[model samples]
Target: MARTPFDAGAEFDRQVRVLTDLGYPELSGLGPERFGALVAPLRARAMAAQESRYEPGAGAGDEGRVPFLLVVSRNVAPIEETMPRTVLHGGRLPGFVDRTFEPGSLERFVATEETLLPDPDAYLLFDIERGEEFCGVVPRDAMKAIAGRDRTLLTIEEGIALVTHFPQVLVKNKCFSLGGSRCGDRRVPAIWISQKAPKLGWCWEGNPHTWLGMASAGTRTGGVA
Candidate 1:
C-alpha cells in the first residue's frame, strides 16, 4: 500500500496547538525573532560546551572536534508519532532511520548518553559532529499520572517545541559547517535538552571544562561579551 504523504507545516501547526494548551503564547505566532529568542540560549550553551570540551592548552585547536547541535523532542505517542519525514538535508530517504539517527556506532554512542525519563513522551539528541539530530517519542500513556501536575519548570510540550523550533532556525541560518572534513566540519558544538528536573537545566558535559574556564578567564580579564 502507498503511504500517505505527510505535511510538515500541518504537523508543526498541530504541535503549536499543543503548545498553546501548555501556555506557550509565543509559539503560536512563531516569528523569526520569537524563534530566535527561544533558540539563542541553546545556541549559546552549545557554543560554551564546545569551548569547554577544548579547554586552554588542550592542544592548539581541533584535536577532537565534534560541532553540531543535538536536538530531541518528546511526544505522547510512539517514536514514530513525531518523526520527521524530511531528511536532514531536506530530501527523502529510503527509511526513517536514515533521516533520523545515522547508522553505525554513532547511534549506539548516543543511546548510551544518560537519558532521563520524565513525564510526557518525547526526547531529542542533536549531533553537532554528524551535523544531524535524532528524536525519540515516549509512550503517551507513559505520563498519565503526572499529566496535569507541574513536575518541571517547563511543561512537556513547551520543552519539545523549544528544541524542535530552534534547530530549524539554526539549519536555515547555516550557523555551522555541517558536512566536511577539516576541523570546521568535525567541530560541531551541541546542546542537549531534556526534562530531567523541576526546572530547565543546561549543562556543558560533553565538551571540556577549559572552554568554559576561558569564558570565565575573559570575564575576569575584561567583561562579558
Candidate 2:
C-alpha cells in the first residue's frame, strides 16, 4: 500500500502545543531555533518508533472480537499486539485521549509468541496501576458497535465511559472536574477498549505516525523542557 510521508515540522508543532497544554510552561519560552535544535530530533525518533506497515481494519472484517488484555503490571505475559499505555500523570489536565496520550512515549513490550495473536491494527492504552482492575472488553459486535458512533467515540471522555462500564471502575477526566485540581497517580484514569475498534488503531488515515511521539518527554536540549 502506498503511504503518506511523515510531516516532522507539523508534528513538532503539534507536540509543542501538547506540551504547553499539559502545563509545561518552559516550552512557551523557547525560540524556534532552540526547539528545532533539541526537540526536533526526539520527535523524529518518536516518529520512527511508531512506524508500521499495518493499516486500520485492513484484515479486520465483521468477525470475532480482537482479544484485548488490560495489563497493569509491567511484567505480564505478552499479548499479540502490545497496546501502548499512557500515564495521566499527577499534575496534568485531560481533555481528549490524544492530548492525554501524546506525552507517553512508547514503552518496551516484548512479544514472545507472535503467532498466537491477531495482527492488530492498533493497541489500547492503560496505566500499570490503574489498568490492573480491568479484565478486558469484548465487544458484542466489535466492528459494528464502534463504527456506529460519531468520531468522538475515540476521545478520552468516551474511552472512560467504556472503562467505567466494567464493575468497580469509577473515573472522571480532570477537565470535567469542578476546579481542575490535581489528582494523584492513584486517581489517574485508564482507558480500556476492544482491540477490534478501528478507531483506536495506531495507523491514522493511512499514516502510521499517530503513535510515534506518543511517549516522548519532549526535547532535552538547552534546558528547554
Candidate 3:
C-alpha cells in the first residue's frame, strides 16, 4: 500500500484536539493574547540566525562556530562576573538546541554566555545552534528566586529543567493542577533530552516566565541568567 503523505495542517488540528480535550485553559482564556503573537517572529529569528552561520559542505565539527542568540530587554542588566555565565533562555523555546553542556553546581544551570539586548519586554530566547532552535523566556520571578536564593520556587535541577524544556514544563504543571493526568504523578513532568516532543508549533501556553512559585530539586543557594 502507498503511504499517505503527511498533511501538516491535519496533524496540527489533531494535536489541538488532544490538548483541547485535556482542558487547556488559554484555549478558552480571556483577553487579547499577545504572547501567542511572538511564535512566528521568534521561529523566524532563530532560523535566520542559524542560516547566517551555515557554511557550504562544512564538516560536523564546524557546528561549534555557530553562536546562539540570547535576546533580552535592554533594561535587563548584564550578567555579573561573580555569577555563572548562562543565558537561561526560557518560555516556549522549541527543543532543538544541545550545543554543549555539562552538569554543574546549582548556580550554573543551562549556563551559556549571553549577548545582551536593549529591546524592552523581550521575552523569547532563541537557542540557535547548528540546526536546533529552542524557544525560551526567563520568568522574572524565577530570576528573583535565584537571586534571593529562594528555595520555594525551584531547585537547581528544576531550574535547569525549566531552561531545558520550558513551555512543556509549564504545560505539564497546569495539566496536573486541573486534575489532568498527562504526566501522571510528576508535577513538572520529565522531558528527556533524547526524546523530543512533537512540535505543536503554535503557542498554547502563555509566557512561562510570568508564572510564579516554581522550583526544582528542593532549592539550593544560587543565581542564573
Which of candidates 1 and 3 reaches a greater TM-score? 1
User: Which stretches of model 2 miss by more than 4 angstroms?
Assistant: 1-12, 20-32, 53-170, 173-225
Residues 47-76, candidate 1: write the lDDT tens digits.
444454433332110211222222223323
How does each model score on lDDT?
Answer: 0.25, 0.24, 0.26
- Best candidate according to TM-score: 1
Per-model TM-score on C-alpha atoms: 0.26, 0.24, 0.23
| Deviation of model 3 at 27, angstroms | 12
**Ranking of models by lDDT:** 3, 1, 2
Candidate 2, TM-score vs. the true structure?
A: 0.24
Tell me the deviation in Å of residue 136 in model 3. 28
Model 1 ranges with Cα > 4 A deviation: 1-29, 55-66, 75-82, 88-114, 117-225
True-structure lDDT of candidate 3: 0.26
